[model samples]
Target: MEHITSVHNPRIKAWKKLQRKRERDRSGLFLAEGRHLVEEALKSEVQVKVIIIEESVELPPEWQVSDVEVIEVPEKVLRELAETETPQGMTAVCERPDRHNLLLESGRFLLLDRIQDPGNLGSILRTAEAAGMTGVIFGEGCADPYNGKVVRATQGALFSMHVQQMDLEEAVDLCRENGVPIFGTSLSGSTFTAIAPQDSFALLLGNEGEGVDEALLEKADQNLYIPIYGRSDSLNVGVAAGILIYHLRGD
Candidate 1:
């Protein structure tokens, strides 16, 4: 293992650049901070390029790292690369999984449209994974799934979930072509219970403030909404997603 004590090291500077979306996009890599995320990345198909640990921190014995490069850095250097306020001592530089070939033939999927909040996006993804949904499709204006807050909020779901970014209309068209029903959530739509549980379908959720895009809603096979019986006018997008994902998944 190599020990790097300086935050100004060339490699450290390169890794730090991943904090920005442009760098992540250009390099096709991102940082997985903390132990849980690093461990999850190692277990997933995603390729972990290198593991960086603070010299004072020890990795779990069970983690397999013989094939991966391990580097040691001082706590200050680790903090330079960490997104969290308190550094977790371990982080990994991982290649972003290729999602270009995701199949749309059959399975339960969560399609997000312009979901801006990183926390909301993360929670929705974690819920989708737990509900056994096939994957997640991110529409334009949605928070970058690789954002630090989003990644941490996922709680390791980022490694296991199949996520794709594209225009939602194209996704809707693909689902329609594949015979998968698309359900959009909206206040004007029918109650969610009105629709029968589906074996395979796509649930289209919208922004935090605005509901699903009106144009996209128009294209959906059906539109539905969770009833707001309480004084509250609406549910948080993440909360609403949890309710609808499980109901639509019917599992």
Candidate 2:
């Protein structure tokens, strides 16, 4: 039954600081707002230090209640802590969940190369998780997975899936080491029907505007392209990724 009402409260200031990345890294914590994400964080093995729930709210049965300090905050303060337009009236400060590096273990993977748009990355991530890809590697220049938009777009898959950050070259090397062949989607590459590999594989997806790096593209063991019969020459990376992931997953 503790309370944190004032915006100037020291703890409040610290919580707000998490809006920036530096503070998040320095503190080893990030903010999770809304009933769903916070609830998911609690269910996850991730460490949750404190939960700031709105005053007078009856929480879901699964919300973490005993292990951590629960504080009651004013609605205004809840709005300040949340990133969405409609504040969920709940937020928690929790440790960054550990992402599994399945590329080092599994033979199936998805490598995203510098795909910088948050929404596309998020959508692809959601699709990847649903498709049961063993893991997802974020190439060096990809958008931040922890970005609020991406995190929200994934719809809580971040809490469950294996997500990693590494350079595209190193990722390809990891796949090779683990006995997985890398596949890249590009125009003029052989049609997916022509060079399809078996179920065990890795997909290298590129940014929307620029596509894959030639260096990595050259390294791909399989070059698969989705044909476009219409005027558009290329599909949105997210859409292409979804199509490729579904096919590779044996949809």
Candidate 3:
């Protein structure tokens, strides 16, 4: 196996660059840190170009890495590449899945608009995957799914879930054509419980502060809101998403 000791090594420098969204976008790759996320990437359709392991850390014996390039680096190098406070000693450079040709299907989906918080976006992705969402569509102003904080926050769900970035108006039209109902969450809408859960639908979630955009809400077949029974005026977007996703899934 190839070994690198210096953070200044050309390859190490490039790997570190993956921390930035612009670099990730230009290279069509992102870094997956920690053992669990690396394992998830290897198990999923994601193409892993390289696995970097700290020299002192031993990987699980059962991991099948013969087909992929492996590199050994010192603790300093791993720390330099890590986004978290504690380094996991394992990281993978993985190509972003090409989702351009992903088809719109008749199943549960989540549509997000202007979700600026990476942590919230990650939580939503994790919850959507857990709730058996077919896919997630990212509208304008949403945080990039490949952002390091977002990637780590998602645990391993980012690997298996299908996500796309597109104009939401187009996404709504496509969902409509596929026979999926578009339900936007807003304060003025009927209580969510009033609407009948369907096998196929798109739940539109919006920015943390703004709620759903007025234009998109107008386009929705129906707008619904979760009731706030307590003194709290609202729920976190991620929490609200979990409740609505499972409820709409009829689980």
TM-score of each: 0.97, 0.92, 0.97
Task: Give per-residue CA lDDT, model 1, range 195-248, as digits (tens).
Answer: 888999999999988888899999999999898888999999999999998888
Q: Which digits, one per residue and each the tens of the lDDT, describe model 3 over residues 1-251?
A: 99999999999999999999999999999999999999998888899999999999887888888888999999999999999999888999999998865566688889999999999999999998888899999999999999998998899899899999989999998988888899999999999998877889999999999999999999999998999989999999999999889888895
Judge candidate 3 against the unseen true structure and give its global Cα lDDT, from 0 to 1: 0.92
- Measured by TM-score, how close is model 1 to the native structure? 0.97
In candidate 3, residue 24 scores what lDDT? Answer: 93
The lDDT of each candidate is 0.91, 0.81, 0.92
- Model 2 per-residue lDDT tens digits across residues 181-239: 78987785888866554668889999888898888999888788999899997898888
lDDT of 2 at 216: 90
Ranking by lDDT: 3, 1, 2
Clashing pairs in 3: none
Off by over 4 Å in 2: 62-64, 100-105, 195-197
- Evaluated at residue 231, the lDDT of candidate 1 is 100
